[model samples]
Target: MKPLVVVATLCALFTLSQQAPSKDKCMCELTNSEKAFPYDKLGNLEGNAVKCNSDVTSQKARKLQSLMMGLERRLPELAKDIAVLDSENDEQMYAAISLQLINNELWEIQRLMDELNSTTLSYQRLSASATQQLKGMRGKMGELEAYDSMQVVKRQQDNRRLTRDLQECRTGHQHIVQPTRRPRGACPHGKFDNVTGPRVNTAGEYPGSYKYGAWGRDPRPAAGTESWYWRVMLISSNKYGHYVRLYTSLSSLIVGVSTPGNILISPSNPTTNTIQGPNAVMYDGALYYNCYNQDSVCRFNTSTKTVTTVKLPAGTRYNSKSNFCILDECYLYTDLDLATDESGVWVIYTTAQDFGNLVLAKVEDTEPPQLGQPRRTSVYKSSVSNTFMVCGVLYATRYIDRSTEEIFYSFDTSTGEENFNVGVFLHKVSPNIISLNYSPVDQMLHAYCDSIMVSYKVLFS
Candidate 1:
């Protein structure tokens, strides 16, 4: 019986050990809170079958409870990590949006810069085109002014030629129609008594006759009574090319009578100091004349025998080469044509301020000769070859021929009337009359004609 009981206990123990593995597997499935708990750990607990029922189970429960407490403490840290990841994802999304916006702004700025550059280039092209147009207009305006000046010169020449022809035709017609026979010895000696045309007084109240005079010998004045003097400027073959010789008697020159007492004026250095123009006038015991190289008026005091000079205004074009009078206008160089009346000395000059028009000024005859304010006259646009003052009236001469000059214009200072139809002809015996001067005392016109001195006795009506 005892033997049979022993066999039953052994069999019961083997069966309990196999059955314990199933119980441990069931407890691990029921108590394991972690989803990733290892099955090998459960099998190891089953092999230790001595403590599988109480100690192993209690130990596993304590370990699981400790693990649960640890997991609870770590839960806040894990949640913080997840929130940080979400914040990083949101920051990355905002960064991508900001980068795209920046690229769009860069493209807009580049477009504006390109448009500004294009506008600047277009403005430069327009400025270049406008400058070229203005230059072309200025060139065309200069051409028109030159053409108008030429036309005025041509018209003046034609009018002078017509007047000369009419006068010659009338003189020839009178001689052919009515011939007057004169007896021998009817005319006085050294006097022209023959008359042509009607005996009409053509000089008209002036104390001078401008009829054709016969070519006679020069009337030699007596010595020590040479109130009327004539000065001639000639180029000498000596070292001084410019020399001025004062003649006491006009007839003495024609008779080849030269006196050592004649006054001779010359420059210390003729190379620099050159006398200009055939126009010279005597006033208040002084001889007023123009200088050639310098734009200056010179005064020679006859008593003192000293020279005084007055400089003209700056930019005054008073050169020998410049024409005194043009076709339609007289230049400032016309001031070389000096004149004197009962009032004072006068000068006709032009300035750039006056637009190249002639201006007349009266000199005060002071120590330095102060010039008054210039007066603008209507005689600027007239062909005045020479000018003279008679009874305060300025008469201008126009060239008719070598032997004739007509007083075709007059400016009356008293009335301010400028007449262009003054048709009084002055017949000269010698063709080359270089200088003409009228003396109020003698009522004679003193003319210097190419080394020959001549005088005409003026007949007044």
Candidate 2:
């Protein structure tokens, strides 16, 4: 009976022990929603509640309650930290966007600066070019003004000389017996041959339209051949400069090959040493040309390769306004009207003292040729392009076109009479004839058209 009572007591004790909760086994079942309690409600801990059964001990529940209270206290700080982090992230995004905008504006500014620099450079270049052109124009105007003033003074002096000449003629008429008129020589009539001569090669060194030229028999030729030579002056298009080249033809003017030789005269001083006009002539062993803008004649000796200048009288008209004006503008300057006669070199010029009459002076063939006293005649102002001598008679030519020129005036040195009945025509090989020269040996007319040298044999009638 005692043993059975003890077994019952043991069973009762086991039952009581099982009924009470063990410390290690005091865990309670949580609601399905409360399983992820602390982590899920981290952002809003105050609004979250953890649910569990009453099987848990009072001590364990109290500890868990303390922990939950501590978590509740930290909820506001966590929320504040999150708010600060969001604010910081927003600030970083704003900074990145602002940086991109500033970079775009900087790039646009740089582009504008580059364009402004390019524009400034172009403007500077244009300004420099315009300044240079203005300077050139001013210089040309000054020269033109000087030329006009000279012409006015010359015309005034001419009027006074004419008054004196008329007075003298009337006073001498009563006392002087009328002289008998001398017999006149027959006028020269001729037709030109058809063929053109060889072209003159100047190596394109002195490139431009031909201005002045001279052709004649070479005073010094090799052995027995009659070598003829030509001197041509080319004016640069700029109108401020000129160059002279010597050309030689081995055969006669009837048929010949022409080649350019040495440059006899160059622009030594471009400002002052320009050749005047188509007034160049070959005499003896020298070439004579008028020096533009200067009162001088330049003589170049072919043998010595030396140049000598002879002074002309002051106030002598030899500039562009004085002669050789082919165009209406008359921008080209020419003054000395040089012609070769049977006697020697003759210069036909107009002086203020001669009352605008043409004066013909014979030049002595001395070292520096001496100019004789001029013989004044009635004014021959009919735009004489060129002058030549045939059998002691001086004939003047007038340029018409590329195909035609006319001989319109003539003067007889022996009889001192001027005739204007000339209607002779020159059939030109080319339209642009800058100069004309006659060769007595071959009876041919030599014409310089641009760079070409053309010749026409005369059929005298």
Candidate 3:
């Protein structure tokens, strides 16, 4: 009766999607997915990782409270199913799923605590609330561990937890994170190697004011704009933006010495096709991003100031249903992550049919935008913090700490090979990186981390 009451409460939070109980073997008896958790593929964030002092603004304290409240709100999503997390004995095959959800929630709680430590204020009340919630959930993590008989369930949740901790043992901030891994693919551009740079750029004009956004070079720059760099910051609740900031060069953008150029996507309605999530990149002469409040990608041309869009395939998750998360926290509305490579424009997303795994599509360079056949992968989107393309290889990163992000997985589109052995660590100048991108022409990665524009260099041989 308790379990039923709890499930009903959670179900009330979402539009009930009632499904008849499986009379056959439970969904738990399903095949052990090769993509199961504790992802053996990914390694930990270890090395002589650089440590930096956190320079977070006080305003972020309020943001932290809001994010924690959101985390509590999302808890119901984990308990909406019929199974109870603590049912003593029942058809509770969903225990493992519930456990994994708990693992993620705990990880996020710990991550938020780390964030609280970095902020200027000691919002003791806020910290206590988060601490109390964390206590309430940690026991569930232990129960999942104690129920080792359910190896399949425990492993799935453990793997997801392990995947998030991909950076737990490391220390750093969000700034410039560059990976220097030799691509396991045909290097049409150059032989890829380890990326390195003077990674720290202080918070942008609005330090900690806007926490989500992206910045990078336009890989396929038009005639006169080869030296330009671009940025798109999600100015509303870290979910939406209507403008793209411009810098004359990487130097100007980094030095904070020049007035950045600007392009408003729309003068009247900021979100007509404006940026929706932080995972956007500037390519050629246009800005590519998730469209406002939709499951689509928007391309805003810099010169014409017009917009072009391509609807993502059906079953795609938008409006934050499928967002990016690391061990610490989840970003909102990052469903359609746009990236660029030596090849062309691309979008990394997830689909319901793919079971929330990653699906990559090439945004074909054409008059009206075209999306290529989506190449699906078993790599779970929830496990990756950010992704980028280089020489047709898709690389995924994970959040490590206050000043670090780690590149832990790679998927080559050309070879259809997934490699999770790339253990590369990057120094972060902020607490979170909402957006990241790679520029082919300059061989650089532009990271929009906690409202600051940071730079890193990744060259191919």
RMSD of each: 54.3, 49.1, 26.1
> Which candidate wins on lDDT?
3
**Ten-residue stretch with the least lDDT total in model 2:** 46-55
Better of 1 and 2 by TM-score: 2
Q: 388-458, model 3: which lDDT tens digit per residue?
A: 88888889998888888988888888668887877666788777778788878766777777787776656
Best candidate, TM-score-wise?
3
Candidate 1: segments with Cα more than 4 A from true spot: 1-228, 236-243, 256-274, 324-335, 355-357, 380-382, 430-432, 457-461
Candidate ranking under lDDT, highest first, comes to 3, 2, 1
What lDDT does model 2 reach? 0.54
Say which prediction, candidate 1 or candidate 2, comes out ahead on lDDT: 2
lDDT of the candidates, in the order given: 0.49, 0.54, 0.71
Model 1, 74-127: lDDT tens per residue?
344345434444444433643343344344334433544565456446546645
Error of 2 at 268 (Å): 3.6
Q: What lDDT score goes with residue 235 in model 3?
A: 69
**2 versus 3: better TM-score goes to:** 3
